[model samples]
Structures are given as structure tokens and as C-alpha cells.
Target: MELDEAFRFIGSKGPLKVGWYHILLYALLVFYNCWIIGFQLMGMIFIGHVPKNYQCTPPDGFFTNDTTPVLDETTELDKCHMYEVQDGIVTQNITECLYGWDYERIIGETSIVTDFNLVCGDAIYAKIAQSVFMVGVLAGSVTSGQISDFFGRKIVLHIALVLKAVSGVIMALLWDYNALVASWFFVGVFNQAIQISSYVMMTEMFPPEIRTISTPLVSLIWGLAVSSVVPIALLFPNWRHYQIFISVICLIGVPLWWLTPESARWLISRGQIEEAEEILKKMAKFNGIKIPNSFLSDDKEIPLNEDIIEPSNKGHDGENEGEVHQQYYLLRAVTK
Candidate 1:
């Protein structure tokens, strides 16, 4: 009875069991690989982040608490308070640093200086840049999806990383907003490509039962990317400077490629059956199982001609008969 229960449990769980290390590695990959989703969310939030350029004053008598005198001139004579005054003129130049040019003029006389040639005074430039980026993403998602499927996922993802690095550098160092606009557009496009590849990679590597659970768990890393950006934005306070910071962090993730394994599905699909079997064997070993010697052979392909053939009668019947005979014989022998 005990042996029967043990056999039943093993049959139900299949031949595979994912261990702690496999789960941890997969979770980490999903986190970093799915970072672009968070960026997409941030980009949507950027719709709010960008506008409200209109300058406004705090209100009337806003600086009423200020009692500091502009000047206090005195001479060392007659109690040295206001005894003697030297013939000197006091003048100061204070223009809008806080309220920008428009609101500054309302408070006092000021001239409109075109200090920021970036993105021009036209907010539409940024709006258009953002729009183009999203469009690039829309198109690249389809294109890269095909590419990753046809080629390997790693190659497709690597290509996107290269594009991202090149575009990021050009955008950060160059003077032309047009170039910045174009580069950022490509950034969105390449980012989508990277994401699609990551998803494909994760899906291929995980087992079917836990596949759905694992894929989204890896995706949770997107939140960290969003949360970290806020501090970088505040600290840098300049757009190009912030872009440089982002570019460097992006470059760091590129080297993490060394840590990951090629997709076992891709290997099998390309007819690299031996390699796929090897990987599966390794996975089994990691899960603390000794894979059968039969599994190690190159005869890994199990042909399925659904229309012409049915399940193997011999193999099925033999398994059932063997188990039943073993149980019956053991009972009879024990009783005798």
C-alpha cells in the first residue's frame, strides 16, 4: 500500500521539479528583462511630467516676512549707528529666477532671455518627440517579435541593446534637439524589442505548469526602474545630465548577458536536440534527480504523426501489466 502511494505521487508530478536556484535565477532575469514595462508606465506619467510650463506667482504679499534691509550704511563716529553716511549709491539686479520670464515681468521690469535653446521654447517639440518614440515602439514591437522568433532571442535582444547605447550617447552629448528627438524615438522602439525578446526567453526556459507564474514574477522588476528614476531626475536637475545617468545604468545591464542561458526551446526548434537534451538533463540534476540513461541518448525526438498513428499499444499495455503483475506476485509470495 505504501509503495503504491509513492508510485502514484511520482506519476502525478511528472519527471521534473524546479529547485530554489532555478527559481531565483529566473526571477532575477524577469525583473531586469522586464524593466521596459516600467519605463513605458513612466513615459505615460511623463505626459503629466512635461507640461505646466506656465509661470505663476505665489500670491500678494508673499514675502511679507522679510525684514532684512538692503543696505545699512554707518560711519565710525557719534555712537557709530547712523552718525555719518558716506556718499555711495546702492544698486542690485534681480530678475526672475523662480517665476520664469513671464511672471518675473509682472513683479518688476524684466527682459525675455532665450537662455534655454533646448527643445526650443516650443513644448510641442517635446510632445512630438514623445509621440514619435511611442510610434517607434508600436512598429518595433511587431518587427522585433518576428526577428526574435526567426533568429535566437539573445541576438535580437543584443541588437536592441546596441541601438539603445548608440542612440543614448548621441542624445546625451549632441547639441541638436532634432537628434535628441530622433534618438529618444529609437530608444522607445529598441526598448520594446528588448522586452519582446526577454518574454520569449523566459517562456522558453520555464516549465509549463509554473511558466505563467514565473513570467509575471520576473516582470515585477519594472517597478524598481521607475522608483530609481525619480531620485536620478531630482539629483541631476538637467535633462542631458539625467540622460547620461540613465545611459550608464543601461550600459550596465548589457554585460548581464553573460549570466543567462540560451533558450532550450529555441535549441530544440532549430533541431539541436542533443543540446536541448543536455540542458534538460542539467535541469534535472539541479532538481536533484538522476535522469534515466535513455534520456541522455540522441534519440530524443518523439515523433507524433497525429493523423496516421495512435499511441503505442505495446508500451502502454506493458507498463500497466508489469505494475499489476508485480503487485499480484508480491502479494502471493508474501502470503505463501
Candidate 2:
């Protein structure tokens, strides 16, 4: 019997049914892909927020608000420029802020913008940080697939998770703007790797019939995770605390390394048939199904006749039959 046929048989019989194992695995994958990925992608919205109310710092004796006139000719207060003031007379000459900027705590207590003083002249660096992170994502997306294909999904996922968490924490603690940007870049890289590895591993383990539903379900989880950023940001207004909070969340998946199983199909493709059979047996036992001794034997030749095989509970129309055959051939191609 083809590996795909065995999977279908196991799925129909009960081993691959939507049970506790499936639920646990799906939950882990959702947390890894949706929650972690969403936070990493959307975190910049809060971290890089530029406060609207800020102006150049006044001299020790001068007190000025955002609307305070810097130049005698105009009533506008420049955020990046300051004018010398003596008594009640303001100097006509305007110069870039020499001391620093004073900001109103209207948006939040702290952000990368406020912490780094990324205003006016340095505001572009905020966008640069975000852009650098995206470039990391693109690089990770390009490379992680090949790495996972070689090293197996579970290990790569865990490694990426660990690295991502470390990078996030480092990003929060970094004092230098360039160092923070560099750390955020790695966070983006490993975040994408975790998403890709976990997602592919999850899909490979699930039955093809369940995949259609699972895909949209994963998306819904992702949307929810993304939407949650606002409330989370509100709760942890400080950028450092927020970064640490989300970074620590990645560690939740570390214990899952023991609970989750490697993809049986991946094992089979790598010629580890004994390991694959063991996992299958465990799956069957969990679902209260007993497999025949010949189910995975090399000498056993199972017929492909549709009449002999039981139809799926979802009903196997011509289209479904075609899909099954296509999957079987695809598996064979991969194995070869």
C-alpha cells in the first residue's frame, strides 16, 4: 500500500480522527504560527509610535509648550529647531535642538521613539528598524524551507523559537539604536522560521480531509492574535516590558517538544519506516483502533480498488478520488 493510502486508511478508521492528540497538536501549531507570528509582525505599531506632542527643549530659564512661538515672525513651535530667548525677547535665528526634545506623555509612558529620541531628524530610523525587520522576514522565508527539509521540522522550529525569544529580549535591553535594529532583525528572521516550520509540520501530520478546515481555522487564530496587540500594548505601555512579555510567550512551546510527534510522512520519506510505524501504532492506540499486523509490512500488497476500500465519512466522490490519487502520486514522488 502507498503511504498516502495508509494515511487515508488510518484516518478513516480512527487513528487520525479529530481527537485529543489532534486538538493538542493543532493548539500548539496555532500558538506558534498565529500568536507568535502575529505579535512579531504587528509589534512595531506600538513600539515605534511617534508622539504627536513634542517640541524642542527650552533653555534653563525659558518655559515653552508645543504651541509656544520660537520665532518672532510666526506663532509656530518647531519640534526640531529652537531659538535663543533672553528675558521677553526671542532671537530671530533658528537652530536645530541642541539640548534635546521635550515630549508630552499623551501616547504612552515610553516607546522606541521616545526612548531613542527618534524625532524629526531621526524619525526615519523608526521606519528603518521596521524595514530591517521585514528584510529579515524575507530572508527567513527564503531559507527556512530548505533548512527544515534537511533537519526535520520540529527541531528547526524549536531552535528558531529559542533564538527568536532571545533576540526579542536582547532588543528590549539594547541601548544603542543600531544594536536594537540588529536584534529586531534576528527576531524577525527566527519568527518567520518558527511560523514556516510549525505550519508545515502541522499540515503534514493532519489528514488531508482535515486540512481544508484547518487552514481557515489557523487564519482565524492569526487574525485574533493580531487584533489582540492593541489591548496588550495598552496593558504594557512601556516598550521594554511589552517586548519582554511577548518574547517570553515563545517559551510556552518549549515543553511541547516532548508532547508532539515528528511527522510520520517525514520519517517515512527519510527511510525511517520503523519510527513511522511506531508513531502510527501509538496514534491508533490513542484513538482506540487496532491495526492489522500486515498494515505496514513490506511484503503486504494492498489493492487500490475503491470498491474494496471503505469510503471516507465525508464521502468520496470522483473529485475526492482524484484528489486522493494525486496525493498518493505526490507522496511517491517525494519519497523517490
Candidate 3:
């Protein structure tokens, strides 16, 4: 079947174009894709990990008794150094937070920064992990897009969802810093794959009119979630628990992935003609409408053959008319 023919047939169908169910399906797909928005921004909390106002941990028994001048001066602590009394005399000395830095518990109840000692000289490691995640995202975007073009969107999306969930959970539990970083990169890779597949499928399933409206409307929720992460992180005080929370939440929408139908564009391009027709018929029933014969058939099914598409002889002087038709239908089938 020709791609434009399918679009034109659906668009011309009076009942399908105005049907409430049609709008609902498009809206639901948008919501599905929007889940990525909040989850994507969740990385911000980890990346923005900052040490709370930290001071050199006090010596043992420094707080055992009532306030002393020795304690009083050290009360106003500094970042990497603290004060102490030596040999019964008040004196200043260099300290390395050898007892470990103490936090004021300001930005979060706990963070990777404090929990993992990703502070002082080790602060760069957390930032490096964040940067590595983005690098993985970049790599996945290019590779997954190419693979989806060859295979299909929905299958790639499903694989990505599973990989993302697995990697996210692994990242949460990993104790080794390098291993955790590696896990995060895979999480990011699958995250990009899921986002891109869903996006392309959304545009393909819906008409241009629906695509125009649904795209930004769905993104609105993502924008809101960006601000909501701060408050959500407040609910998970420890970085380990928060990471677990994020991973668990990532799976909440997995079942919904099953709700979305595979892209007919992909099916047709792969020459799954019967499957494509079945999807079209299912959509017609759900929309409470019928497909026009031009796209399908009330009499006999339209063969998804190149011969079915006529050459654009009027435009190309009949020289590459067959080529023009091939380009027109298959490109639409591949891209729709």
C-alpha cells in the first residue's frame, strides 16, 4: 500500500477524523513518551550532587561534655580544616577530615557526594560519571536510530526498555565506582533508544494534525517533572535508596509499552503487508470508523506491490516514473 494513500484514506474518513477514541489513542501515546522527560531529568539530581556544608569531623569525645572554648572556636568549622586543643593549649593545626567530613544535611538527607565520599578531591568522579552517561546517550542515539531503521521501532523500544531497567537497577546496587559508572553508561544508552523509538512511533501513528498538537502537549508534563525531581529526591534521603527508587519507577511504564501498537510504517517497510492491514483494520474499529477503499479494500485487499503505485509520469517525463513511485511509497513506509 502507498503511504500517502493510507494517510489520505484515513484523513478523508469522516468518522475516523473526528472520533474521540482516535484522539484518545494519540494522547495516550504522548503520555507514554512523556515518561522519559521526568526520568531524564532525574539524572540532574545525581549530577548536581554537592557536599553539604562539611567540616573536619571532631575528635572522639569532643562533644561528650558541655561547651568549651576549644569546641566553641571549632563550632564555626571550615571546609577541609578544623580547630583543636593540643597539650592543654588552644592551637590551630592542619587536619584532613581524617575522621571523615561531617555534613550539615542541607541539600539532601544523603547524596552520593557524602555516601560515596565523592567530595573534596573525589568530587570530579561524580561529574565524570554524569558526562559519561551523556556520551553513552550520544552513541546510542546514532546507533539505535540506524538499527531501528533496519529492524523496527517497537521491537527496539521494547529491548531498550528492558535494558534500561536492568542497567538502572544494577547501577543502584553497584559498590565499585568504575562498575557503577559503566552501568550508568548502559542505562543512558538504553534510555536514548527508548526515547527515540517512542518519538518516531508517535509521529508515525498519528496524523500530522495530531502530531502537531500532541508533541508539545506531552512535553509539557516533562517540563513540569524537571522541577518536581527536587521534591521527589527529598523523599529518598540516601543516594542508594534514591537510585533504587529511580530504577523502580522506570519500570512502572513498561506494561504501558505493550499498549502501544507497533508502527505500521515499519511493518509495511518490512513487507509485513498482512500485519500492516490488520493493524489498520484494528485502528478503524477502535476509531468507530471504516477504512476507505483507496487505502484498503471493501471488495478485495490492496496488494502492497510496487505495481500498485503508479509512476509519476507527469512530473518526471516518464523516464524514472517507476523510480519515483518506489521512492515515494517505500520512503513513506520507512519514515511514516
Largest TM-score belongs to which candidate?
A: 2
Cand. 2 TM to true fold: 0.83
**Candidate 2 error regions (>4 Å):** 9-16, 66-76, 86-90, 292-294, 298-336
Candidate 1's C-alpha runs over 4 A off are 1-16, 36-121, 218-225, 281-289, 292-336
lDDT of 2 by residue, 1-336 (tens): 455555554554343445555666778888889888888788888888888778888777677652245544876566788776656566756677777888888545688898989999889998999899999999899999899888888888988988888999999999999999999889988999998998897788766778778777888788899999888888888989999999988987688778778887787778877777887777656655545553554544333334224443334553564444423222232233
| Residue pair clashes in candidate 1 | 30-218
Q: Any runs in candidate 3 off by more than 4 Å, and if so which?
A: 4-25, 46-48, 63-76, 83-91, 106-108, 292-336
Let me know the TM-score candidate 1 reaches against the reference structure: 0.60
Model 2, residue 324: distance off in Å is 16
TM-scores for all candidates: the values are 0.60, 0.83, 0.74
lDDT of 3 by residue, 1-336 (tens): 455455544433434443444465566555445654355547547544786566656666664111122334575445654555465443556545556666777655765567667777777887898888888889888888888988888778877877777887888787788898898888778888877887787777766665686567667767775666666677776676766666666665578665667788788778676677777666666654455432432233333334334545544454664564544433233222
Model 3 C-alpha lDDT versus the unseen true structure: 0.64
Clashing pairs in 3: none
**What is candidate 2's CA lDDT for residue 96?**
78
- Top of the candidates by lDDT: 2
Candidate 2: lDDT over CA atoms?
Answer: 0.76
Output the lDDT of residue 94, model 2: 68
